[model samples]
Target: MAITSANQLELLQTAEAVAREKMIDPGLVVEAMEESLARAAKSRYGSEMDIRVSIDRKTGRATFTRVRTVVEEEELENYQSELTVEQAKQYMADPAVGDTYVEEIPPVEMGRIAAQSAKQVILQKVREAERDRQYEEFKDRAGTIINGLVKREEYGNVIVDLGAGEAILRRNEKIGREAYRPNDRIRCYIKDVRREQRGPQIFLSRTAPEFMAELFKMEVPEIYDGIIEIKAVARDPGSRAKIAVISYDGSIDPVGACVGMRGSRVQAVVNELQGEKIDIIPWNEDQPTFLVNALQPAEVSKVVLDDEAGKIEVVVPEEQLSLAIGRRGQNVRLASQLTKLDIDIMTEAEESARRQKEFEARTALFMSTLDLDEFFAQLLVSEGFSSLEEVAYVEIDELLVIDGVDEGTASELQARARDYLEAQAKAALDAAREMGVEENLIAFEGLTPQMVEALAKDDVKTLEDFATCADWELAGGWTTVDGQRVKDDGVLEPFGISLEEAQDMVMTARIVLGWVDPEELASAEEDETADEEDEA
Candidate 1:
C-alpha cells in the first residue's frame, strides 16, 4: 500500500464525518483510531516493546514511536522498555536513569487483517458512544409521553423507533386489543431507561395511570396552566378509568374543564385510547366526601369509615348495588384504588339487618353480664351501651341521663358493672396462676390480667415464652385447625390490644428476661451509638 499526500487528510475527514453521523465528539473517534493503529503496530514491532501512535489533528498524518526508560545497569528488569545507562549513552550523551527515550518507527502499512480489526474497533466505539448519548437524552424524560414509529414486533413486544433511538413497548405495557402496523405512529409514556450490556433500553407504556394523566394535561388547558390539577388516577386499562381533579380557582369546574366543551377534550383522549371510557370527578379533602364522589353515578346512602383499618363501608339503595359494584366489581375496585382505601358495598336493607343484629347482641350482653332485666337492658342498649367496659367506664352522670334512671338507680347499675368486671379479672388471674404464668410477666407494664390469662391458655406462661412472641402472635394470629389455616378476627380482638401495644409489651418482656443474645445486643448498641453521633 502506498500513502499519497491527498489521502493523508482522508482519515481526519472520515473521523469527523462519522462522529457527526453518530452524534459523538470527533476527538473521541480519533483517539479510538489511534488506539487501533497502536494495537496493529505492536504486531510488526515486538509485542514486548512499548508502542504508541499519535495522529496529527491538522494533517491526519499518523506517527509511530517506541518508548523506553533509561535505567541503571542493575535496575534494568525489562530489556524492551528499560535501557541500561551504558546502552543509553550509545544513543545520546549524558543519558541518566529515569530519562525517557523515543525512537521514531516507520508506520506499518495496515494489512487486510489489521484493517478488519481497526474497523471492528471503530464500530464498537461508535456503538458505545451512541448508547451513552441515548442514555443521557432519555434518562430524565421518563414519565413523559413519547411519539415514535412502529418499527417491528418481536414475540409480543413492539419495537418503536423514536428517531434518536429505539424503544420497547413490552406486551404487558401495551393497551389491550390495540394493534399497529409497520410505520404507524404510536404514542406512549416513557416508563424507564436502562443501560444494559448491548445498549440503552428505553421502555414505553400505554397502560400506565401516569400516561392518562399526561394525556389529560395535553388536552386540558386549565390543567396545563395550573388552574386545575390532577390529584389521582386509577385505570382499568383500555376499558375504563377514573381521574380525580381539583381546581385552585373556585370559579373553574375542574371536572368540566377536563371533560371539555361538548365533551370534545375527553372525547379526544377516548379516541386515542381506542374508546376507553373515562370518569372525571372533582376531588375533595374530606375522605368520606371524596369516596362518595369517587363512586360516581351510584348514590351512597351512608358511608362508615374506619380510619385505623383503612376501610370504608358504603351503603346504597338496593337498586344501586349492582351499579356501584359495576360489572365484575370494576367500579368499586377502581374507587378503592383511587381512594387508597378498602371499600365494602352493601345495600340499605343489608345495613339495616346488620344494625338490628348488633342492637340485639348488645342487649343480650347487658342482660347476662350486668344481671339487668330485659326492659333495663333494652333501655341501656338504646342509650348506646354496647359493652360491659363501656358501662363500667362511663361517668355516673352519663348513666343518669337515661329516662327514669335517677341518681340512685344509675349508681346501682354502675356498681354492678364494676363488680362484674372485678369478678372476671379475679377469675382470669386465678386461671393464669394455675396455668403457671410467671409473676414477672404478670407484673410487666401494659399486660392486663386478661392478656396474662390468654398467654397462659396458649402455653406462653413463662417469661421466655412471652419474650419470644412475635408482634403478630401477641396481637393476633390466624387459628390453625386440622393442619389448615383458619381466619379469625384474632384471640386478642375482644381485648382491643393494638399492634403497637403488643410490640411494647414484647420489648419490655425481652429486656427483663435478658432474652437478647450477645450479637443482637452489640448490634443494638452500635445502632444507638450511630443515632447519638448523628444527633450530635
Candidate 2:
C-alpha cells in the first residue's frame, strides 16, 4: 500500500478541528461520515455490491475495503472474473470451497462524496446538540412565569423570544383586549414546555385567571405575606371579573386592601386587563349574603332560592335588575359561573306578586276556623282556632276537659253542631243550583229555610228531607210552636229521623233529589264558570 499524501492529512486535520470546535465527539463525526458514504454508495452502485470505509482515529488516515460472498455460480462477476483461487490464496491460506476471501482496496478518489457527506453530518450533529440544549433549558420552566421579548406575530399568535429559546403565545392565550407589538416587554405565565424535533416548545398565556391571580399576589402585600387569601375568582376576560377574598386578621378589610388606597392596588390589575371592571367581593360564610355581594353595585332586595333547580331568583329594583343581569347577561352569567348558581334576576313587581300569593295561602288556613261557642270559642282563641270548623271538629275533646270545661259547658258546645250541619246543607243546595238545578226546585223547597229553622231548635240537623220536601212545606215548616217560631221535630218526624239522622239525611237528599245529581256537580260548576266567562 502507498502512503497517503499531505492532502488526506489535511482533510483529517480539518475534520478533527471542526469536531473540537462544535463540542461533538470525533467518533460521532466519523460514524456520521461513514453512514453518508454508505448512503452515497448505495444510491450509485445499487444493491448488487457492497462498499465499506473506515477512519483510524489515531493516525487520521482513511481506509477502504470491498466485500463479496463465496458463491457456487460461475457466472457471478467479481470472484469468477477477477479473483482466481491462486489470487485469493494470498488473502486466505485456508480458503475452502464454501469460504469467502477479503481484500483491502487502496484509497480511491472520494473528494466530492466526502465533502458533501461531511457537510450533512455537521448539520445533523449541530441540530442534535441544539435540541439537547433546549430540552435542558426549558424543562424547568413549566408551571411558572418566564420573561420573553415579543418577537413577532405569526398567523395571529405572538412568538416570544425567551433568550435561550422561543415560545408561542397562541391567540387563545393572549388576553383578548391586550395587544402585542414587536419587542413589547410583557410578562406571561408559562403554562408548559414540550420537546419536539424542532426544539423545546413553550406555551404561554396571559388570559388565564391564574395569571391575574398571580399578578394580584404581586401587587397585594397581604396576599404575598399570606395575611389575605383569594378564595375564588370568576372572570369574563376583557369585560369584568369577580374575585372573592378572605383575610386571616379580623381587622383587615379584604376588599378594601385588594382595592388599595384610592383604587391604586386594583387599578394596577385593571390596567393589566385593559380597563375591564374588577369586583373584589369579601368572602362570606353565608351563601345568601355572598350571592348578594357577588352581584355588586346592583342592590339586591331579596333572593329566593330554588335549590333543586340549582337556581336563585334575585329581586332588585326595576332599574337595578338590568344591572344585576348585566349587559348581554355577562354580569349574572359570570356571577353564576363563579358561584355555580343559576341566577334569575327579577324586578320588585314580581317579588310583590310572589309575596301576595304566599299571604293568601296563609290567610285561607286562618279563615277556615273562625266560629265556636264560649267554651269552644275561648279554647280555639287560646289554641289558635279562629273559625267555626274548629269548634265543630275539635278532635281532642280532652282539650276542652283540660281547661276545666264542665258537663253543661261541654253540652253547650254542640249548639253549632246543628248550625254546621245546616251550613253544609246550604252548600249542597248552592252546589245543586250550579248543577243546573231548576230555579223552581231550589225555590220549591226554599231548600235551606226549613233546615235552618229546625236546626235552631236542635230538632232538625240536616237538609236531606228538606231537599226531599215540597217547596211549600220548606217555606212554611218553621211554624210557631207554643209562640216561639221553630221548625218542629215533627217536620223531621215524617222521615222517622232523629236530629243527627236529619242532618245526614239532608246531605243525602240534596245529593239525590235536589235537582241535578251530585256526580256531575263539579263539571256543572266548571261549565257554569265557563259560561260566565263567555258571557263576560
Q: lDDT of each prediction vs. the true structure?
A: 0.88, 0.68
Q: Write candidate 2's Cα lDDT for 207-267 as tens digits.
A: 7777778878989999999999988888888788999999999999899999999999999
Worst 10 residues of 1 by lDDT: 483-492
The TM-score leader among the candidates is 1
True lDDT of residue 78, candidate 2: 63
- In candidate 1, residue 98 scores what lDDT? 89
How well does candidate 2 match the true structure in TM-score terms? 0.51
Q: Which has the greatest lDDT?
A: 1
CA lDDT, candidate 1, residue 6: 69
What would the TM-score be for candidate 1 when compared with the true structure?
0.86
Q: Per-residue lDDT tens digits of candidate 1, residues 18-48?
A: 9999998898898888888887888767778
